[model samples]
Target chain A: MSTPATPLTDEELVLERLVALLEHVAADVLEGPVTDTGPGSLRRLGLTSVKLLEFLVAIEDEFGHVWDDDVEESVIGSLDAMAAHISAAGVAPAPTKRD
Target chain B: MHVKGIESWDLAYDGRQALHRTEDGSELYYELRGAGGPVVTLVSTIYVVSTAWRNFTGNLAGDHRLLSYDLRNQGASDGRPAEFAQHTEDLKSLLDDLGIERTYLVGTSISTLICRDFANAHPERVAGLVLVGPPFSPRGSSRRRRIAKSWLAALDAGGPRALFDLIYPLVFGDKAIAEGGSGAYLALRERFLAINSAAQLRANLREALGAGDQVERLTSIEAPTLLLSGDDDFSTTESTLDATAEIMRNAAVEIIRECGHLPYFEQPEAFQDAVARFVASVEEGTFPAPWTAPATEGKDR
Candidate 1:
């Protein structure tokens, strides 16, 4: 059977979903050092670039999108920044990204 | 009392000594016991040494060959000048040196991670796998990030002691620790910590820690797989167990009742039975689920 059309086009949603994913990755996977946070308190998590790719794969699974062409290297730097990327893509950020 | 039918032997691989070296050129140690068909090996994880597999191996070796080795940087293996050397390669080299064509794999702790990678890269070499306790990984329900925050890098700096203290609680469940033999565990621990420098331990950790989402990499492991864990194993949470089983094309998961992380140590009888059942199932060419997608079904396009 042919697939039904998606309401949101693929391009419009990719970046935003990836940002949402990075935030989730930070809390659960990376356990970012900044347990308490503000715009000024971005402490680094231990995830090197290669491990970060694993998180990206999980996000792609959660959103059902192929991260192959959509992921940008800079978009994953921080949870707040990642949230903004996802929010810009129209999905509202959840109250907590820990799960 | 000791396990009733338990056995021990000092057999060698391929009718020869089973000694092999690590990635850093450190000689590793092992004792091969039991004698049945051929199940490739036994590998050490963090704290418990290869000796822990003594009884289980004895029981299963009737028609199978069991190879249990003290991994480099741990147990009787040489731990000097350690660095994150090629662990899978060390295992392969052991097999190659022994002249054994192929056999099943059974490992514990994070040894499963190493075995999983080896199984992926050399699918042809692995007949089946029985991994116990699982290990630390980001894929779990919730990871304990706080306790050993600098643990890995510390091991890289100091040695096994850098994380062995924290790891003890993670490896042995609460009851086992309180069973009132603190000296036994500490002595065992000191022996492990004394050999390697912290930096070498760190290198071992970096190399042995779980590969990210091995669930995906494990997709390529077509061998029948068996996973054994305890209900209260802190190292392997429910989510991690479920995620692993979901991804493997052929696999089965068993939770040992009233047991801790060291199922082989905590409940050797049950562990033995579980192994017997899984191996029998493997010989029959079926599992609770296939370890990979049915090759008969074409690609998932």
Candidate 2:
């Protein structure tokens, strides 16, 4: 018997969704919509680290990914960088089913 | 060591303090004791310094190589930016500096998140986890916001002194308060207040609340785990720990009686017993995998 392989999500589509997510989180914290300068823009806006952590959580929720040890500070540095990182990293693999 | 009283002398006498430098150039103060066996790093409660572990360290140190450290911006550790993530990194660096490959993590209060996160991020480096009063889940955002607003209002209305007074009951159990009296509780209260680190603690608290939910990710944890929460612990209750245990592959839960959040200090004998059993199981390779561990059968010790 043959098993069906999981379909891969398009990278651009993933990036588009992530950008939208970041934009929403930024607006929530900044109290207004922000330009797509990426997460680096967050630092300029004087975003607190607590808010930054919330942003990361939002990103994880959006991409279905958790921040691993390899995740550098720069991964969330800007919108474009984060989007690219998410696109390249892709959605975190669904945990394998256990008995 | 600055030994002030008999209590201070009891704590300072056992372990030698050292500064573990991180790549960020911040130095974390830690004290290590014990001998040839599994390494156990005790992450102190945010409310107290490393000495808070003094009650049980003597017992723990005899069988396991135990290490306890002050979180950055608390105790003897140098002040720098206090981010929850940075605290985890500091722990990683602390373990590395000590040349410890893998060890058991014993964390209390908010530091429980540190142990879990470290285990999640570096599973190979964590042999097992003992989380006492881990904030497995926090109140909803609106509720948290309301509570925070009220707290801030109180802070502005009164001051740190008043705020600390208000939160004292939540920190210590009725039994502890009754035993220690207003005086012992006051002495313990004075320790945190005297440090003038309210702002530091506030920042850490905010980070912890905003650190996001880890419920979905608990299945990723592979290490043998033991969770402890007090019967009187209002924050992280038995129900919360029960929910937490359901997700882990291997976990055991114990609710300590006549204690609140800080069991290590509140009930050291009971705390030591739980930890000693867990550590021994891990060392002997007899710890059941999370999948095999009984899900709903945690004992109340």
Candidate 3:
């Protein structure tokens, strides 16, 4: 059997680190307006593309990596969205969803 | 480019020694950038040096009459302990010095926490206030109280850098520190950090962290207030600071995205955008709901 699935790579580790930092940033500092899950959820957060760029700079600075090089816009847009990108990038730990 | 979208000037508040001096003989040094209506005061957060707000003042300089002062016994000012009353007086004095009648006051961190106290004491003096990144609670923690006590002791001996080194790391995330290390960003850390003495730094820190528990007086603030903050600021912890926001029935909330403790620095453009919108609403003589919290909460790993 293929050697038990190898552990996350260094890039993965870096991506995970980025996600962790992103989560902290989202929860503690730049909390957009609370968004309800619906077609209109995006309108409520009040986060514009400029705000997203700010987040992009933050993630780049924190992980010592540029935006496109490591993180995709899909990942940096929101906490879970960013985490999913990390997972997809083969970096972050699989998220555990709790109801 | 001119910071804050306007011209810049080296404005100093003169104490007896020279600069922005208070009635009690304290001094407040600050940078003035901008020209226009809607006079605004930007109170520096205690944890970081006033320069930490370069991103803030830089953007706000030209549009509105902006005054970002290094609090008394702070930022190239004298080394002395200051009380809430003393700060309120300093602000009033600064405004008077500039011939500004009633101006908007914007405070972050510790300064934001006390906007109400200032408003309560001198309601007629404040036109409007924007309280951003207020303290978690007004009640002093033992550690905080000890730090406050320590500041009284530390103020006289050293300079801003020595004091900043102790406090900066906590508020500044890895980016600022690392970028600073990369020699990629401006290398004014030591210079900006070194401007004040240890005692003066402590005085500011003490005033900020030691200022715990003012929720009782929140209702007294009659000024139109805009509560600006980010959800991810672990230090202030939105829930706790929101209690104060809740106290101000007339207050509105603006929370940015992906910003940490110092969102103004982390995201100046966003900061400007959010505040500009708020200021517009205030000017239009109407207040909107501001930003609302997301209904769906993300789970922690």
Candidate 4:
């Protein structure tokens, strides 16, 4: 769901998009409740390493920006961190593929 | 007991090799042997099929109804693209087809991962767990990914023979390779070569490496578990078993000396003794938790 001409900065927009993407990608595990916050560790929410990898790949495929191999694991540690990484990498939103 | 070639020995038991169809139209071949006893099902290692457990089944079949099966796209089973969930589903379907209410599970290598997954998802169906030389992803995600990539790259570069050659030494004990008077090593090599194929290897590799982390779910497993490893094995060391057992409520670790990854093959007597003793203890309701018993007291090393 896209907001029309919302008064949000580019970084804010990227954060919003990432939060939506993560919630969408991990709906199976994270659907019951918002156990962890935007800055909290996703591992506590039961996002396994395999699921994390799949989430990263989905992010890459949707944004058309390859995740750098050297990127620290902390980048995906939380929604805020992931959004910051996306902003720093200058990734733009592309058409999402329904996996 | 000098057998010439593996062909001469009749590996098949009565009521052997039947296919059960899955919802996706894939047929999985399973063998049922012995009867009127506690049920035990063998989960095959990634590299070999049901026949790999023929001798092992012989050790347990007299007192326990034994079941063994070939994983999908391997051995006599029909080919389907491999996925982690498919293995669990195929196993669930096989157990249903055989009318087995609950069973003790013996899982080797990658199949051990499947066993844990199946148990976590359907704890009521699993009576006990026996894990042998199972692989687990290490600490880091990238490192784990790299390990999987390196394995696939080796397979893609030189195909199945390369994969076989790389794994053979690690799986068999160095002592066995150097001093087992019999030609078991060569025979095993021949079997590996005969079984190797591009599609089969690729599918098995995918299944082996694609399994998700079950470490967190181990605490929920209500079944008593026997964690086994070879003393000389480079993979899945005793420390690994200890870490795994710490989470399990009723778990014990057993280490077989002078063997490698495949303790059941290299040291069948020791393997059988450990299994028999464990099963007996479980049946008699005397199996001790790891906290109470000496670490190495379960069976003679």
Top-lDDT candidate index: 4
lDDT of 1 by residue, B88-202 (tens): 7778877877776787888786678778878887888988888887764435412433323456855656446546655666666565555523332433343344334565455
lDDT of 3 by residue, B171-271 (tens): 55454445433221112332333354555566666666546464556766788887777556645666665665676757776675555566666556666
Error of 4 at A16 (Å): 78
- Model 1 stretches with alpha carbons more than 4 Å out: A1-99, B1-18, B21-26, B79-85, B136-150, B153-162, B181-183, B190-200, B209-214, B289-301
lDDT of 3 at B280: 67
What are the chain A TM-scores of the candidates, in order? 0.43, 0.61, 0.38, 0.75
lDDT of 4 by residue, B200-227 (tens): 7788777667777655667767888888
| Cα TM-score per model | 0.60, 0.65, 0.60, 0.67
Where does model 2 exceed 4 Å of error?
A1-99, B1-15, B138-159, B288-301
By lDDT, rank the candidates, best first: 4, 2, 1, 3
Roughly what TM-score does model 2 have, to 2 decimal places? 0.65
Off by over 4 Å in 3: A1-99, B1-18, B47-54, B138-166, B173-189, B209-212, B290-301
The candidate, 1 or 2, that scores higher on TM-score is 2
Q: State how far residue A52 of model 4 sits from its true place (Å).
A: 47
Local error of candidate 1 at residue B195 (angstroms): 6.0
Per-residue lDDT of candidate 4, residues A30-55 (tens digit): 75644344655554454533345456
DockQ, each predicted model: 0.01, 0.01, 0.02, 0.01
Q: What is the lDDT of residue B253 in candidate 1?
A: 73
